[model samples]
Target: MVRRVMVDEEGVEMRVRINDMKEMVKEAVGNSGSSQESLEGLVKFILSR
Candidate 1:
């Protein structure tokens, strides 16, 4: 299934992007940045999916 989802390098890149965005949100929350709102929005989005 993993192989099927990641058929090419572009798929790998997209996965990396998602991971990076998740990490950024974690850092923002830890540093008490204004990203809190955005992070919450992201969480809601993921949950809605």
Candidate 2:
């Protein structure tokens, strides 16, 4: 539940979770990352069509 997850009241847990997500996103978009590869593949496919 939302109440259970945010029990700290100061939102420390929420901030930590957000920061973790941000790090993951940065990695996913970094050089040779899966997301970057996937985007390149999609662009190639669209261009070929």
Candidate 3:
């Protein structure tokens, strides 16, 4: 696992790391997520061209 730090320079600070695959997948499939929507748009544009 990789180590990371999340610092709220104006408030608080904490150590965190993204070690959850399921959480990542859930976010990647969210209804209006940028990554998913952008990918779909890209495919559609390619097909239309």
Query: Evaluated with lDDT, which candidate comes out highest?
Result: 2
lDDT of each: 0.81, 0.86, 0.62
lDDT of each residue in 1-49, candidate 2, tens digit only: 6665577655777778889999999989998888999999999999999
Residue-by-residue lDDT tens digits, candidate 1, 1-49? 6774589777888888999999887877775666776788889999999
**TM-score: which is higher, 2 or 3?**
2
Q: Give each model a TM-score.
A: 0.46, 0.65, 0.41
TM-score top scorer = 2
- Kindly report which residue stretches of model 1 are placed more than 4 angstroms away from their true locations once superposed: 1-5, 36-49
Candidate 1 accuracy as TM-score: 0.46
Winner on TM-score (1 vs 2): 2
Per residue, candidate 3 scores C-alpha lDDT tens digits across 1-49 of 1232333542223222234655677788887776789899999999999
- Output the lDDT of residue 37, model 2: 93
Sum up the clashes in candidate 1: 0
Q: Poorest 10 consecutive residues of model 1 by lDDT?
A: 29-38
Per-residue error at 43 for model 3, in Å?
A: 0.3
Better of 2 and 3 by lDDT: 2
**Total colliding residue pairs, candidate 3:** 0
Q: Residue 23 of candidate 3: its Cα lDDT?
A: 68
